[model samples]
Target chain A: MSSRLSLRGFLALSALRTVNSLSRGTGRGSGTVAGGRVGLAIYPKLLNDLSKNRQVILVSGTNGKTTTTALCVAGWGDKVCSNATGANMPAGHVAALSGSSSPHVVLETDEAWLPVALEATNPRVVVLLNLSRDQLDRATEVRSIAERWRSALSKTAHDLVVVANANDPLVVYASESAKNIRWCNIETPWTSDAVSCPKCTQSIVRTSGSWSCVCGFTKPGCVASVSGSEVRIDNETVQTSLSIPGQFNVGNAAMAATALDVLNVDPSKSLTSMKSVTAIAGRFAVRTWQGRKIHMLLAKNPAGFDALLQSLSPGTDDVWIAINARIADGKDPSWLYDVSFEQLRGRKVWCLGERRLDLSTRLDYANVTYEVVNDLNSLPKTSDTTELLANYTAFSDWMQRTTA
Target chain B: MKIALIYPELLGTYGDYGNALALSQRSTRRGIDVDVMNVSITDELPDADLYLLGGGEDGPQRLAADLLKKSSLKQRVANGAHVFAVCAGLQILGTSFCVEGNDAYEGLSLVDVETTRGSVRSVGELLSQVGENKMVGFENHGGVTTLSPGIEPLGTVLHGRGNNGHFDGFVTETIWATYAHGPVLAMNPWLCDEVIAKVTGNNLTPLKTAADQLYAERVTSLSSR
Candidate 1:
């Protein structure tokens, strides 16, 4: 395919590169947003033109987009481009595709922006992950987003493949009208967002491993699934020995492996490549704090938090929960109630962050004892390893402080 | 004292359920014993000294209002049980409120008030003053409530939009309803103590601790911003 760009597209690409370099030269953080904005402002259809001839794969959902995108990039092997950072907006897409000459591109996308990005990329495969309430102060309701996805995917061409999570009712409902779909049975621990069927508003009946509603909406038969650390696709089973420590990551790997199968890639090679990815962006990074090895985990919503809590070892007790209510963290911390913190009934919890008081209050209701530490330096010294779970901005601050 | 948390599965969207936790913690801190009852929809409403309700989405809010209307919840409130309701809970306790387009549901009428959809949804940090006590919390709701004649306002809105853009909440002899839900009682310990005092019919001594300092800092930081 010829990589020819129109005059306006070429100008936008050139402007993006120049601004990116200038932004990095000054230390104004990553130039992804700034450059992408300039490029799109100049040429409105820059993303469409850049991705017209390339085979694009779009990964999107409420959570795990960054990690799943990284896995997909690893599965595609060499000569593939992707947005490795957490930037998933249109500007970020333009920035990632502007300088690459690769024919294959894997991109992470925001849930609300999936429809717009699908139109721009016209992707060969779209991975639909679980949907849940996230940043409700800034985001629309979960059902509204699902409705938008259903409409957008229904209008796509017949050959376009959709990889959806079968266990999540919302995902099944959203991709039901797709021409071709590969269902993956990824077990979801959070079901509050999908208690009512998206199709008929009836209560969903859930068993140990599956869910169905009286309205005829139910979990689809899976073409791909993950059991323990193994991913089963068709007649073959690939062992996923990933350094990332969570069943959720195993489920993500299964989704990536299935998407690779649609692209005619070897599942064994994809699993091998995925094992090399220990951390996506900065999530699941281990850091030493106060003479203890602390595993840092990021959970922006109740569903993500529930997954993290379920993945913890039975013996793991010492925990530090950090919360912040900044602009990027959605300002309203009312979602804390939705999270089941009762699991930490007998654990020692140290509440840290701008909203530590709010968390302390939550822990009090959970019948859990906790200590409020305003300053990180004053955090008590623990000999055993501890786990740190933080929301968006708090996670970023801790990563910057410990890594710097 | 026994505190019943009403329909948590349906009406526990925001951290409004934290109010129950706040009451338990504050009561324990004051040497007052309290038992918390988690009540679901299918279960019968248990009689208690106090009832706690939280906020939720429109569908669940309507379901809760319908369920509570059929039960004897109004008699419990009328018998002088201390009740605290937040956002959707406040709306469900009023005489009537709009749930969605062109549809309204009748509330338990525990308080003499009515609710309608606000012109714009209000979401932000809320600061108010109830008598000599300063109340701080977060408010996110679309219901605009109007109090009946001779009804008392919960507090005056000092910052951000409160109940109808002016008043923060409503209060009767034994019930309190408000849109401010940082689990209102958690951020405003004084209000929690006041509610407890009303239940036990005794003036409880206040204990100064780190929560007060955190509350003060939050109020300062949010107000200045």
Candidate 2:
């Protein structure tokens, strides 16, 4: 494949490697977007070129794309190559694809970029985890993304199977047009994003583990269900002994196992293989810092925040909450209000970040008491475990500080 | 005081429901009792002193505008109920608003204003001079609102583009509307208190908390940047 490339294609693939190696060698960029940028600049259709003749599987949603992709990659073992780093864009896709000539490739696509990925990759299977409002500055309207997904799903090949979340009405609406589908009822708790039906302009009524709209947009009967810690697919229920902290990961595992089943992988082997991935990038990573055990969770949006908060509540622990409004994190921090901050009222909280004031104002309105801090050194030495919950760049900054 | 949080399922995008929390907490801080009714789409609109609406997507915004037009909201506003709305909430309160490139929808007509598609969608930090105090919040919307001859704007734009890039919002004795959504009330406690005062028919006492300090810091930092 490399020997028969045109002059531009050869240069683009070569440039991808040279730039990635140089960027990683220098401390300027993390080999995430730089190399891909240069490669795509030389060859506009670089992604399509790299994806040809490979069995592609796309994992995309508002949250857990990284974890779900990692689980799928781990399930396939050495046979699959993926963007293990948190780079989920076109450049990153091209760069990741340049690493190996493996016939199987799993890509964690961004929510808005899913339709683009669908058109580019023509994936054998599309995994729709869930959709909620995340980066409002970039993808402001949740329903518009659903509309695009509806169109993209309708246009895909009839043989293309979709592993979707039946718990999320938005995901159901997006995956409705797929001919081959397997829905998973993982009991997702966040319903703030989709209370209205997308097919018809009517209110959606949600019950336990299911929902229905008056105009007949109903939650389809799923093949997989997460009961307690076990994922039941068909009649076989396997206990998902996942090492991750939150129930959301249980949902991700269920979806990954179901998607792997579509790829003809054994359910037991796929779910077991997924258990090896305890932390995705820096998410759910814990380290000892400043004489206190610090647990770090990358919650970048309201959906993530709600999931993380829901998992770690009904207890008392001082949490260091950090927020940043950098371009990667979406410049608009207005979504902070979408989060349920009132849950943190009983816990002692510390706030610091680029946008701590905005976060502090949100906490103030929730009537939660918190102290503003300057740095990690100011953190009082305590016996109780202190957690670091940060969004995007704040997580990166804290992860860097702790690692350094 | 009865405060109605209207159609949260339809209009609670961008944390617009935080306004109800601000109003309730401020009222409680002043030793004033208040009832916050979270009105759903199917529930009948309850009679209340103040009605609060938040931002939403275009589809929900259109649905909410149609629903409110048929509801008792216009009658309540005529009977002197204080109303505070943000973004889509504000858009649905006007006479008419443009959406989806050329489609227009009829607003609730509570405010003598109209909205049209702007050259660019206004996003990011918004700062406006509200008489002596500068109000700061975040704005993300596509429509630019224009006032009628006899109407008044909420404030003049100071930093970000609000309304039509010169003015920030629409205001009258009974209605307060804006495109800013720092949950606006949480970012500007004075505006939250003022709405409560107008609805309760009692002057609010000087009550300070963590919000004022943070508000001052945002205004300072955003101004310098």
| Predicted model with the maximum DockQ | 2
Clashing residue pairs found in predicted model 1:
none
- iRMS for all predictions? 2.8, 1.5
TM-score of 1: 0.91
| C-alpha lDDT of all candidate models, in order | 0.84, 0.84
Per-prediction DockQ: 0.41, 0.78
The CAPRI quality class of candidate 2 comes to medium
Model 1: runs farther than 4 Å from truth?
Answer: A1-4, A25-31, A288-293, A380-386, B27-35, B42-49, B79-82, B99-110, B200-210, B222-225
Show model 2 residue runs off by greater than 4 Å: A1-8, A26-32
Each candidate's chain B TM-score? 0.95, 0.97
lDDT per residue for candidate 2 within B65-172, as digits (tens), equals 888988999998899888888998888999999878767788988888999998888888899988787898888999989899999889999899999889988889
Best by TM-score: 2
The TM-score between candidate 2 and the true structure equals 0.96
Please give the lDDT score at residue B186 for candidate 2: 76
The alpha-carbon deviation from the true structure for residue A355 of candidate 2, after best TM-score superposition, in angstroms, is: 2.1
Worst 10 residues of 1 chain A by lDDT: A24-33
